[model samples]
Target: MPTLEPSAPPSTQAAEKASRALTIERLQEQAALARSIADRLPWQLAHFDLDLRCRFGNQAFCDGLRIDPSALEGRPFQDCFPQDALPALLPRFMQALGGEKQLRLTEQSTPGGAHTFTETSFTPDVHDGVVRGVFVETKEVAGRARVDDLAQNKRRFDLMADALQDSCIYFLDPVGRITEWSESAHRLHGFSREQVGNMHLADMAAPRVGEEAEIGIDDTIRLAIDRGQWETRGWLKRAGAEAFWGQTLITALRGDNGELEGLSCITRDMTAMKDLDRVMNDLNAELDRRVTQRVRQHTVPNKDLDIFTHSITHDLRGPVRHINTFAGLIAEELGENASEEIRHFRDAMKRASQRLNAMIENLLTYSRIGRIDLHPERLAMTNVLEGVVSRLRQAAPDRQIQWEIQPDLPMVVADAAMVNDLFTRLLDNAMKFTRKVEPAEIQIGCRTESDGTCLFFIVDNGAGFDVAKASNLFLMFQRQHHSLDFEGYGAGLALCQRIVQRHNGRIWLDSTPGHGCAVYFTLPVETAMAASGLAALGC
Candidate 1:
């Protein structure tokens, strides 16, 4: 073996030293880089030595505790934290040091009367298989928790907004730019989310100008922000260039600093309500006008009827008494010597007087039916028809007629006496028209439609009129058939039309020359009963 030289030994020693130094430098660089990374971490980071002394603390930890990082180094963690919070924090720290794995803790603090929530984790730091210290990463959870809470609140608010049926809610900034809009707002204004956002509130106003109209919407917003709230009701423009009445309320929103941030707006569509009010007003006006006209038209006629009643009473009594007295005188004067012609004349005079009395009674009844106040009731139609047939049998004993009344006919809401009068007139017409047919037939029935409405019809195999003259059929004192064929004052059909109209129903005629006639009338469905409750009573 060759003897080692001193120079060679020195060179080899230098090389070994360089290699050891480089390894140590690499380890130091890695440690420094880790420290730098820990210091700049977004979450609060801190390191403690085995002696329970803080060896290092990042800028985030320093900021969170409101302490200087340089001053915090080498300080005991117990000394740095408040005395009350240390006990709770100690257990987690010790757990990480005991090799029980990392631990997490949630803590709370009320500083300056404001609560702060925190989530902290303790991770053990080991070196060369020896537990040296613990690393703590703390995150401020107060802000994140508040944000989550706000998100949940917004979800609930959105659901409530969608559920609303009557009112629309929206939000705008103090500068009048729309920020948020609800589903109802979209439906009422006919604006989508893309169309509404960033739009000025004034853009929703109607085109017309008036004293009640909004002039400067931006100025109104400023006023509202200053005063806290404002409200108004007026016309608003819709997407289709239509206008609708709306009631709007605006309120200012303030920030934590009590500075005005935005405005909250709520609008309610009142178009239907306004329309109903206008229609009611028009209807009342029309009713008043019609009543005035009717009073004027009937004043002279009523006076004439009164005068005729008085004069006819006196004139009829005088003639009837004279005829009776003369007939008695003729019968007594020609006893056993009386001619057959004399007896026949006496019988004829008595019969004519009786017929005259019957005619006068009928006239009085007809006038009463027209003038009497209508007292409507819900009556069984079957009973009414039976009553009418009984009355007709007594009136015209000589006529033979067949009645076909439908069983369980739908009940009609009308005046009992007026309905009786109507039936009497219809049946009397039928009897007269079908006098030559020998077997006169009359049919009455009802049918229910798909819409839940009921229709009533009266059919008669009688002398029907031409379709061209149907318009004149319901006029007062206008008779299509001759008086010699059907004796009537022609007031019945007109009265029927009036009664049907009063009940919010309609009546019409369907007939042709030499064919049977059918009179049809319609009543509203049950669903509409609530809207027109008085319709059942023919009001």
Candidate 2:
């Protein structure tokens, strides 16, 4: 067996270096071919470095500027134009060096003693997230038609930006300096157009806490360049006022040649929503803290936990009752004069209060199930199931149902009252879920286990659910199906679970989506194994 060495041999190292050199040589060849193509183009093109000195010039550039090709390279931009033109041209070039693209339409005097309209554009040369130089493209335009079209489109966009009230839209140069500010932006940011000119967008950002504060405008610009757009939420400072929560969307605008031209920034004030979210988070934290403290102090019997639940629920009922009473009073006062919209609102209020009251009642019921003493006896499962089904049929008399009951079900030692409540909730669930079925079918059966225990199941041909979500089914306030399809408080299974636990039994379910489901539970048939009286709960 040969072992691999840690370091490469000298021959392998030489081969890698040769491969890299070949790749670089190929790239240089491609660059030269591109330059040759640019030299032949009719449009004048030149490159200038950060020092404002020309680095390269094509044939057209030398002919248009009337400068020798040899002298053009390494010459200052100021010497290329006439003395009078420098005043107007210098500022535009400066903006380009600062990462802003510049476009100018000027009338220039030709050597033939004639004036011609010229269109010039200065595009920044950015490399590796740094501004290296600028590329200048120039051509003579015969008429002013192109200039008129550009001016008209600019006006239309300005009008559109001004019309927005709740949102502010602004434009930035390629390097994130403010280039265009609208009237709406002025009102929202408290900055006039003159004040915002050449200002970096990051100046308006409010001081933020935590790690997010470390991310600056340059980071956002780079992200937008990579992803085309970026969205974030943070505080934006307003002049002479408190900072507001702003939801900002930054989009990178690119030219036809895939070069970054500018950025479009839109920010919407979201202070109210931010405040509401903070309030909710604080309330949740406080509630959790109080619940934790109470649990720690009352680690006694189940009776104490039930009393605590009852006391809190009792306090909550006062406000809900007030809302219900006031809503009814308002409706009665309006009487026949009330409009349909007002009446609808009044009814919605009533429904909300009623639903809240029902939830509280269910909570109380769940809390009491474990506290109350259990009376153990040999209870007949068949009779318990029959009574529950009879009440459901009476409640919904119009519905047709098919019942399948296995006769002579094995008896189980459990609390008759608790077992009856358990069957009522489970049977009621089967009926509610099967509301859409043509003929609802329910099956009830029980079998005696080898360990002297009875296993019972209730199968319903109803709207089923994925068996994977069974863990949440026994939790309070968890519903597998939508309430609009079938009405439920989401507490039936939780109550059933509580009852089964009190009797020292186990409960589980199995189902296939869109078909049906079966709930199974085990109860001890032997009296010795049955749990009786008040039992200490871990909860």
TM-score of 2: 0.43
lDDT of 1 at 100: 42
Itemize residue pairs with steric clashes in candidate 1: none
TM-scores of the models, in the order given: 0.43, 0.43
Tens-place lDDT per residue, model 1, 362-472, is 555444444455566676778988888888888889877888999987766566666676667666677666776657888888888776567888888877888796678
Error of 1 at 422 (Å): 2.4
Go through the candidates in order and give each one's C-alpha lDDT: 0.73, 0.82
* Superposed Cα deviation of residue 100, candidate 1 (Å): 33
The global Cα lDDT (0 to 1) of model 2 is 0.82
Query: What is the lDDT, from 0 to 100, of the residue 349 in candidate 2?
Result: 100
Query: In candidate 2, how many clashes are counted?
Result: 0
